[model samples]
Target: MRIIFSLFLVLSVSTIFSQEIETVQDSAIVKVDSLYREDQFYLGLTYNTLQQKPQGVSQNKFSVGLSAGFLRDMPINKDRTHAIATGLGFTFNNYVQNLAITGTGEMPFYTVLDDKTVFNKNKFTQLLVDLPIEFRWRTSTYESYKFWRIYGGVKFSYVLYNRSLYTDDQSKVVITNNIDFNKLLYGIYLSAGYNTVNVYAYYGLNPIFKSAEVGGENIKMKAFNVGIIFYVL
Candidate 1:
């Protein structure tokens, strides 16, 4: 389903640009056509980390994930160096967590792990779709492809899928719920680099769970991601 969605997004962007090419007489369009490339798709792979997860929920430092999607870059002024990049994107994140969740509806919380809690594996994953609005500035001409650029923005996402897993010596426990998770997530991101390889970083602005409790105390966790962004233009 995700692969299909990505294809649809790419095709939709290509179709839009094709329509614009037919109607607009701007030199930028002509230059873009001459380049024989589309500059609207972005793909990223990132490392995920937990911030403020229940006091003792240990995590692997390098839990990683990926995201891909399309963007529309709309120039803001006559110089055309500054623009707003807005689009839909899909993201998947995985965290290697050691803390176990043991919460109910009214009051949700997590338990800390001690030396006695031996485990082979434990992880949490989430799939989401986001809308990003960015302020973009680039040093590029219609015919130039290798240029320095900076893009920073806020993104809002809806969680489409989520799962948790726990495994020990003999048994595996999979959890779809325990903590009361928020369906919506919002964050800010920044991407900057020359050419196609850009550095990407994101920080969540809201908690992962809604009014949840940990060891009888209200606790919240936010996510942070940093990685490389690839622009297939």
Candidate 2:
């Protein structure tokens, strides 16, 4: 009967091309399990508010610290949304204030009428060590889970040591021969995080102390900063 109607129309066109190749391999295994199924890491804790600017001093003081770091995820367009992160860290600080001396401010000369020496006072403390590198702009959906993230970076610091001394009454341990640690610092950071805890702010254009003249006139050191970060993952 015409060769069984041409073998039943070639087995119905080979069963519709084998059901369209198993529906394209089950939609590519659900798009590779939603693109890279999961594997990322992060652990963090940071706090910084150190300040110093002495080129023409107008009185300024602030210092507080603690930091730790490690974060990963850098994606540059691949239907992976977008991501970037790089952070390495260290911070330990303290800068308090209360100094007054102006009775013609005779360089370290105390006449008992005006001498409130407590500027740059240290009692075995003053440390700052930092290295922060960042760049992140992720709008979620790269897959593992994200609610928000926005970062900006640039942070480098050095002042790994400090000293303080004062022990009189026949014990003599006065080591306050002008405190100034030639450190090079730069800042401009911003951050926002959720699920791991992140919040930061820093603004220092470099000026912690390189100016002098207590009775001749000339001093500068003052800027601004803010902080709060905790992402122990």
Candidate 3:
């Protein structure tokens, strides 16, 4: 009976020691994961929509495109609850249309009077290269409640290529003639996302053109963008 009691005691001690070792291993793994996530890099894609309201024009217009870019998190605290990311990307848009023509200057290429070519209102495409920077704030941890993220940044884009107009149609015009293809672009971005879906908006602080005389004195590009982004290492 004394030998059996000794055996049971040894078994119980061994089980407790095994459980303690497992708990330590689990804790070490969690710490490693936290460190990795804090310093990781990511890339994503987004769909964007733009609007322009020229100072003298009465109509409000919009454009749509897809954007691709890379981002990195800049943690604001040791816990990595807040971060900032900045990167460069390109946006591709097609089936574009121009809405709201004002003044006596409506383009003949887009008007009903044009017999040679007409604006489909359903067919146009624009492509741009953009740079974006965002400041973000996040929740404390993966299991935390009341979770949210807010980002504000800017994007500079140049219309690298466009398929929305006709070369023969002199009526379709963008006023800025001296635009430095390398220098001129739009700016400012704000967004909110939960987990994998984010809604973003942008505003152009600079004119796409060098002068207002051509596209007009007050034409500007402003946009509201809504798209889904997945984090990939």
- Which model scores highest in lDDT? 1
lDDT tens digits, residues 38-111, model 2?
11443333433334522232324444555555555566667545655554555654444322222221132211
RMSD of each: 16.1, 13.5, 6.8
Deviation of model 1 at 105, angstroms: 9.5
Cα lDDT tens digits for candidate 3, 1-233: 99999999999999999999999998888433463332123334444454564433222244455667667666777777877676667777543333322222222222222333354333335577766777777664744433466777777776776443423333443322123222446678776666555566555576443333324244444444555544434
Q: Give the per-residue lDDT of model 1 (tens digit) for 95-183.
A: 88776653333343356666688877777788899999999888877677788889899999998877767678887766674347778
Candidate 3: segments with Cα more than 4 A from true spot:
1-63, 98-124, 142-146, 165-183, 209-233
Worst 10 residues of 3 by lDDT: 104-113
- State every prediction's TM-score relative to the real structure: 0.79, 0.32, 0.59
Order of models, best lDDT first: 1, 3, 2
On a 0 to 1 TM-score scale, where does candidate 1 land against the true structure? 0.79
| Local distance difference test values of all predictions, in order | 0.80, 0.50, 0.52
The candidate that wins on TM-score is 1
Cα RMSD for candidate 2?
Answer: 13.5
